[model samples]
Target: MKQRLDKAGVRFRPHFKTHQSWKIAEIFSQEGIRQITVSSVTMAHYFARQGWKDITIAFPLNLREMDSILMLPEDVTVGLLISDSSTASYSFPKSLLKKSVFWIELDTGHHRSGFSVADFHILTWVIDKLCSTGAHLQGFLFHDGHTYNATGIEEIREIRYNTLSRLSLLREFLSEKYPGRNFLFSGGDTPSCSQELPMEGIDEMRPGNFVFYDLQQLALGSCQPEDIALSVLCPVVASYPDQGRAVIYGGSIHLSKDKLTVGKETIYGVVCSEEKQSDMRLTFPGDLPFLTALSQEHGVIQGTAEQILNLVPGSLARVIPVHSCLVVSNMKQLVSADGTVFETLNLHSVDF
Candidate 1:
């Protein structure tokens, strides 16, 4: 994958929030992935302790964590995201102004936290303020998060094209106005990064979910089921022969409440029997056909009596979650590809 990315001239900075394990992170590090994108300051500290030199906290800056931000090494090259608010402008400790890098987030179309391209005055003012603070304004960062709402490949392509076009226009404007000012145009979302979208203006791509593609990504055409690298193992505890339903120990706490279904059938999670490890077949039995509902500690799998007759107590079933990000964030540990248990890395030790 590294060679493939290298051949495409796309610099990779995988998001560590997906699998918060230094051991998994070490794998990427061995592949020459020095730079990484994390979601929180706590995560930054965690990875920093793990010897990651270049880290970007991809989420909007939480000003309260300024002290934690300052604790990072000066040579580590930390990059933060800034919105239009004056909060971020004065949030950073003046002592580390020169040590940190900043990325002014632009709202291409995601309408999340960034200033829109149409709000040029506010953006320019924010840029000027950031520059005045003596901090390096690295570039513009954007995430086409709306791609997750895409219904098909065509809509996904439109989101990708429109996002890049807006960023490209902003990049050109920035270049013409502030000539010779080194600026990067970084943008990414799992769908945009995984697809054959044009990434000409994008300097760096940050796609976290690609590392462990989930069932939602598979349904969206972002990745294949084989590309999914993680799955939750649950023990089947009971079966209702008459109702054609089975109860699993896994619930929202383990597999998450996220759902991905077609029409009336609810496939809250993909089911894989233990026997089908090498060739896993995702099944949603007919009749009571659905991995329908999830409570705090149980997942109600609705299916036919004959379909679930073979499932017995103590049997292990693999469940693929709809969203890996939410699942991993809630889990305390992760099992590697080799079936080794690794403790989750703690992000922030001290409150900011």
Candidate 2:
């Protein structure tokens, strides 16, 4: 992903919420990426303690967590996201407001958070209000999350193209109005960053899921099978060869309940053979293995009789997650192939 961004002529400040492992972060640092993005203030703390100096909390600024937000280590330059004008005017801490950089969140099409793309009133209002108070305004940042539903690579490219074009227009409008005001346009979720999308208007990208491409990214055409880097290993407790299925000790708690539908059936996760997992390759079409059912603590894998026989009694089935970010949060730590256990956030992985 860093190479993808570098090729697109933009700076890479990837979101760290997907892996959240300081040890994993060491890998990113080794690649010379000095800045990062996170989902919450607490996550900022986790990475900050690891000596990450430049961080952006990608979520909206929580007036509730203002205390903790302000207490972040002094050396770290924190960039906060704000969607409402009120967060810039009265509620924001006056002392910290002057020093902190604020990025106004604009909704490209998601409708989840951020001000509407059509409404520049809230954006200009917040910018002027913050400027009057001597606050460091960092221009516009958006999450083009709607690209998750893109039909194919072409559709994904178009969605990203249209978004960058619109954001460019807005940047010109703001530039003409403010004259001499320098604003950095930051955007792009995994879909846009991973696909062959336009980056002419994008200054930086903070894509988290690209770090560990999942089954969802595979379905979106944003990543290839080999790009996926995370999976949950489940132990099969029972198997039925005649029934062509096996029950495993992994479920929603281990792998979040997120799923994607193929044909009329739902797929909770992808089931991979031991040899396939060793090579780190996945097959998503034409009789690809998958989990058919999931409860709180049990998952049923439906496959051929041979597939079932191989999973019989105490064998391990590696299941690729539909959402790597949620799975990482659930598992909390990662065990490398060499049996190196890497801790994440505040939780330790189950030591074997």
Model 2 Cα displacement at 15 (Å)? 0.6
On residues 174-227, what C-alpha lDDT tens digit does candidate 2 reach at each position? 879889878888996898887666688788998999878898888787787777
Candidate 2: where are CA atoms >4 Å away?
A: 277-286, 346-352
Q: CA shift at 186, candidate 2, in angstroms? A: 0.6
Q: Per-residue lDDT of 1-352 in model 1, one digit per residue for the tens?
A: 4554566687888888888878889889888899899998888888888888889899888878888798887678888889767665574667667667899887878888887866767778888888887778888888888888888788999988787677777777888888988888777678877877677767788888888888788878888667887788778899886887788898888777788765656678766543443343344443223567899999877666776775567886567778888888777788876779766753323332
| CA lDDT for candidate 2 | 0.82
Error of 2 at 335 (Å): 1.4
Candidate 1: lDDT of 347? 32
Candidate 1 accuracy as TM-score: 0.91
Against the hidden true structure, what lDDT does model 1 obtain? 0.77
- lDDT of each candidate versus the true structure: 0.77, 0.82
- The count of backbone overlaps in candidate 2 is 0
Best by lDDT: 2
